[model samples]
Structure formats: C-alpha cells, structure tokens
Target: MYKLKTKETDNSVIEFIEQVEQPKKREDAYRLLDIFAETTGFEAAMWGPSIIGFGKYHYKYDSGHEGDAPLVGFSPRKAKISLYFATGDTEREHLLEKFGKHTTGKSCVYINKVADIDEEVLKELIKQSVLFLQERYPGK
Candidate 1:
C-alpha cells in the first residue's frame, strides 16, 4: 500500500511562516494566512511542513490511490509562493485570467509575492477549490 507523504501535521502555521528567510515572503505568508482563513471560514492548519491549509477532503482515485488533502492551501517556498487549488476546476482558469502575475502547474499556482496577484481572485480560487473538492469527494 502506498502512503501519502504530505499528510497534515500538528506543526504551527505561524511558526513556519516566521521561519521564512525572506521578510517579504514571510509577510506575504501571514497575509495569505489571514486571507485564506477569512475567505474559507476555516481555521488554518499545517499540511506537511510548508503548506498552510484550510479545510480538508478525502479522495480515492480510480487507481485506488486514496488520501486526505487540504481543500485549498499555499506554501511560501524559496522560489515562489505556491497556491493549491482543484486541478480541473474551469472557474479557476477563468479567474486566473484576471489574477495578476502568476504561473501555473497542474494544480498549483506560483506567484512571486502576494502583491503580484489579485487578492479578490485568490479568494475566489480558494472558494471554488473548496466547493469543487467537496462536490467531488462528497461526504468524505
């Protein structure tokens, strides 16, 4: 059986943010924490070591790979701030069109800083991600 590496931990989100070497990144992380918490109406929790996540849902793929993951999250990495969102949400793509400066991975958006992106769009992405995941995973 395969186990997920990025499981949620009891680590303090504030402690993690404070450790970010870049002052701007650390400040942006705190801002993101506040924005995500306010937008999702859920308490922030540490997902793995770096990601500050809000809410969670369990997922089982057709291949039987199953795990619980944060509905929305972000990590202020050395290179960029990575924002996690539902992979196939069309609304996410639409919102990103107006989301200021950012890059995208399959399920993550990378931004240099919080000021590089539109905060309203970020909130919408977070909202859509939670809704999409909840609908996809249902009661889980």
Candidate 2:
C-alpha cells in the first residue's frame, strides 16, 4: 500500500493552493475546491505535491493491486486544471458533452480555466462522478 501523506483534511493543501503562481489558476483551484467540497461533502487536501484532492476511498482489486486513494481531486497545472473523477474512463463520458471546453485523461478532466467551463454542469458532473464511484466501490 502507498503511504498516505496527509489526512482527509489537511492544511498543507490549503497553503499549497494559496501559493500557486498564477492568480487565475489559484482562483480556479479555489472554485474547484469549493464545488468539490460541497458536492462530495468532504474537505480538500493536498494529495501530493500539487493535487488538491477531495474525499477518499480505499480499494483492492482482484488482481492484487490495492491502496487508498482520493475519491476525486484536481490539480492546477501550468496550462490547465485537471479534475480527477476516478471513474472517468470507467463511466462518465456522458457528462463531458456539457462539460464545456476541457481535455481528459483516463481518470481526469482537464480544463484551461473555470470560466471556460459551465460551473453548474461541472457541479452536476462531480456529483454524478461521486455517485458512480460509490456504486462501483461502495465499501472502499
């Protein structure tokens, strides 16, 4: 199992977000933090060096891969913000239509800025992602 760096609620993450270089990126990070917190009913934390993660779950795959991970998270990258919906590839593309202008990873949705996306739709997508994960990995 990978060591858990911070608790579900940690101040380091807040400090990191505040220290982000770009004002626009920092603000967008805060917006993501707020929406994710409300949607998941969990506070945000710094997952590692830069990821502002919300909520968490521990999972063990039948293949023997097992570990604890954040339920959803986002990182303020140089060119965009990456929001992690672990179930993105598993099932969540339907929401992408209304996700506005954003790139995607197997488990992440990358947006240049919050303004470039629809907050309302994004919020719903976050909520949906959480529900989807819960249904897929309930006890985790």
Q: Write the per-residue lDDT of candidate 1 for residues 2-104, one digit (tens) a residue.
A: 9799999999998999999999999999999999999999999998888898999999999999999999999999999999999987898899999999999
Error of 1 at 37 (Å): 0.2
* Residue-level lDDT for 118 in candidate 1: 86
- The RMSD of every model to the true structure, in order and in angstroms, is 0.8, 2.6
Going through the candidates in the order shown, the clash numbers are 0, 0
lDDT of each: 0.92, 0.78
What clash pairs does model 1 have?
none
Residue 131, candidate 1: how far off, in angstroms? 0.7
Clashing pairs in 2: none
